[model samples]
Target: MNIQITPLTEDTIPGFHHVLEEIVREQKYLPITEAPPLDTLRTQLLEQLRHHLQHFVAMVDGVVVGWIDIKPKLSLPYRHVGTLGMGVLPAWRNQGLGQALVQLALKAAAELGLNRIELQVFEDNAPAIAFYQKLGFEIEGKFRRHARVGEQYRDALGMARLLEIAH
Candidate 1:
């Protein structure tokens, strides 16, 4: 399969949402079981674009199959930090897509003057935890029963990676 990693564009928003919904419906990786409304997602994406944030998508033969995004904190004290979110379609997992996407985001964050990147992953997702660890992320804390999807209660591990910013 031919895979290309590129910045998300306005035209690709629908494709990105499709991949996101597919992953969310699986009830495995992300906290939400459903994708947000399309218009809402579009507005959010537009805002990210407006701010020139780090939002990227992996396209296979021109179709979005996975995405990774980092949004900096809005508060003055936390503006130097960014929160990361990523998802790869089940079929696209196990390949190097996730690593590539995240690495690019990390580099961009450092260039954007971010001092740290943070993420929260469900504890049951061992592969994701291991992946983050391999990428130099450390588990800072755990949120007990952080998420409840229906009758299932899941614990979340807060992980972060520090970036070195050049003067």
Candidate 2:
């Protein structure tokens, strides 16, 4: 399949949301098991873009198959850091799409003047943990019983990567 990674725009929101909904309903990853309203999602995406948050999407044959985003802290003390979020469709999981997205995020973080990027992944998700490790992220801490899904609690690992940027 032909895959392309590009910065997300308003035109791509619908397709991006479709992939997110499918991935969320899989109930295997991500905190949101259900997608929010379309307009709301679109507005969120646009708002993020307006605020120096960078978002990129991986499209396979014109359909969004994965996405990565980073939101930088704005305060003086924490402005050098950014938080990351990303996912790939089930069918696209093992084919390097996720890694590619992370690479893009790292570059975007540097462009945004962020010196470090961090992420949180559900600890029970072993593959995700390993994947983040492979991408130069190190586990910094664990959020025990971070969230309740039904009766059980899920733990998340806080991982981060330090970037060398030319200031």
Candidate 3:
């Protein structure tokens, strides 16, 4: 399959939304159990774009199958850091789409002058943990019972990588 990776843009919004909804419905990962309303989703996307948040999308034969985003921590003390999120269509999960999306995000982070990037994953998601580890992220900490999944609180592992930016 021909795969292309590109920055998130207005033209790709529908495909991005479709991938997110599929992931959310799968309910095997992500904290979200349901997709947001289209209007709300559009508003949030606009806000992210307006603020210079970095987002990348994986396109398989012209269709978006995955996405990755890293939003800068805007407060004074953490502006150099970016918190990341990513999702891949279930059929494309093991095809390197996730890796491509992440590497693209990291490059964007470095380009944007971000020194550190991180993400939190549900503790039980071993495949995702391994994927992040392979991408040079290290587990920095674990939060106990940090998020609610249905009726139970689940632990989350925080992973981060310090990026070397080109001057």
Candidate 4:
């Protein structure tokens, strides 16, 4: 399969949304069970682009299969920090697409002067936790019963990596 990783663009938004909806429907990876309305998502994506956030999508034969995005923390004191989010279609997992997507986001984060990157994962998701650990992220803390899906409450682990940014 010919895989292409590129910055998220208007043209790729629909594919990106489709991939997200698929993942969300699984109800095992992300906290949300459904994607936001398409128009709402479009507005949010445009705002992220306006802010120059580091966001990327993985495409196979012109179809988006995964995405990664790192948005800067809002407070002035946390300006050098970014929070990351990502997902890959089940069929595309374990094929290095996730690693490639994250590496690109991290490089862009460093280029933008971000000194730290953070992410939160459901504590029950061992594979995802291991993936982040392999990428140099450390388990910083855990939030008990952090997310409630229907009648179930899940714990979440906060992970972070400090980047050595060169002046």
Candidate 5:
């Protein structure tokens, strides 16, 4: 399967909405709500794209199968840091699409002058944690009882990847 990464554009909004909704629906361990209406999602996505973030779509066979977005933290102290988020369709997972999306995000972050990238994953999502770790992310912290999934409280693991570490 040939996978291609392209910059997200207004024309691809519908495809993005479809892929996002499908991914959210198939997520078993993570808490993901149904995506907003298409119009709302389009507006929100355009607004975000206009900001300091970059969004990319992963396409296979002319269909959008995944997406990744990264934005630099705006706080003065965190100006060099970027946060990344990604989602892949259920049928597209385990085919290295997730890793490809993340690598694209990292490249965008580096181009934007970000020295670090961070993300939060639920502790129970072992596969995600392993994926991030395989990409050189290190667990930096944890939030106990951070989110409620159903009746149980779940912990969140904070992970970060430093683009350049001073020796």
Candidate 6:
């Protein structure tokens, strides 16, 4: 299989949305209603791609299979830090796409001068936690009962990777 990672563009918004929706639905996660409309997302992505963040879409055989996003911390003291988020379509999971997306995001963060990268994974998501661990991220902290998934509160584990350290 040929997997290609490319910077996201306005024309790729629909493809991005398709992969995002598939992942969310497969994971039983809520749709991103709080995000702006599709046009807004496209514009925001373009702006971020140009300035503050890096968004990459993974394509296989000309179809979007996953996406990854990395953004610098918004707060003043944490400006050197970046956060990452990613998802792969269910049909594409366990095929190394997630790992590739994360590595790409980390590389982009380093190129953007970020020293630290962090992410939050639900405590129950063992596979994700393991994946992050394998990529040199350490569990730095946890928020007990912090996230409400559906009607129940769930703990979230904070993971971090210091770019200064060799993987």
Alpha-carbon lDDT, every model: 0.92, 0.89, 0.89, 0.93, 0.85, 0.81
What are the root-mean-square deviations of the candidates from the true structure over C-alphas? 1.0, 1.1, 1.2, 0.7, 2.2, 2.7
How much is 77 displaced in model 4, in angstroms? 0.4
Q: For residues 15-36, could you state the per-residue lDDT of candidate 1 as single tens digits?
A: 8999999989988788897999
lDDT of 2 by residue, 36-150 (tens): 9899999888987898988999999999999999998888999999999887888898988888899988998897789899999899899899998998999999999887666
lDDT, candidate 1, at 153: 93
**Tens digits of per-residue lDDT for model 5, 23-139:** 677645445557799999898888878777879999888789888888888889988998888888878889888898898788888888888999889898999999999999999
lDDT of 4 at 129: 98
| CA shift of 153, model 5, Å | 2.3
Q: Name the best candidate (by lDDT).
A: 4
The TM-score between candidate 1 and the true structure equals 0.96
Off by over 4 Å in 5: 27-30, 165-167
Worst 10 residues of 5 by lDDT: 24-33
Clashing pairs in 3: none
Q: Give the TM-score comparing model 6 with the true structure, all chains together.
A: 0.88
Model 3 TM: 0.95
lDDT tens digits, residue span 30-108, model 6: 3242435677777778777776787899999888888889889778898889888888887888988888888888888
Every model's TM-score? 0.96, 0.96, 0.95, 0.98, 0.90, 0.88
Instruction: Kindly provide the TM-score of model 4 when superposed on the true structure, using C-alpha atoms.
Output: 0.98
How do the candidates rank by lDDT, highest first? 4, 1, 3, 2, 5, 6
- Candidate number that wins on TM-score, 3 or 6: 3
2 or 3, greater by TM-score = 2
Residue lDDT tens for model 3, 42-116 = 789989888889988899899999999999988989888999999998888898778878888888888888989
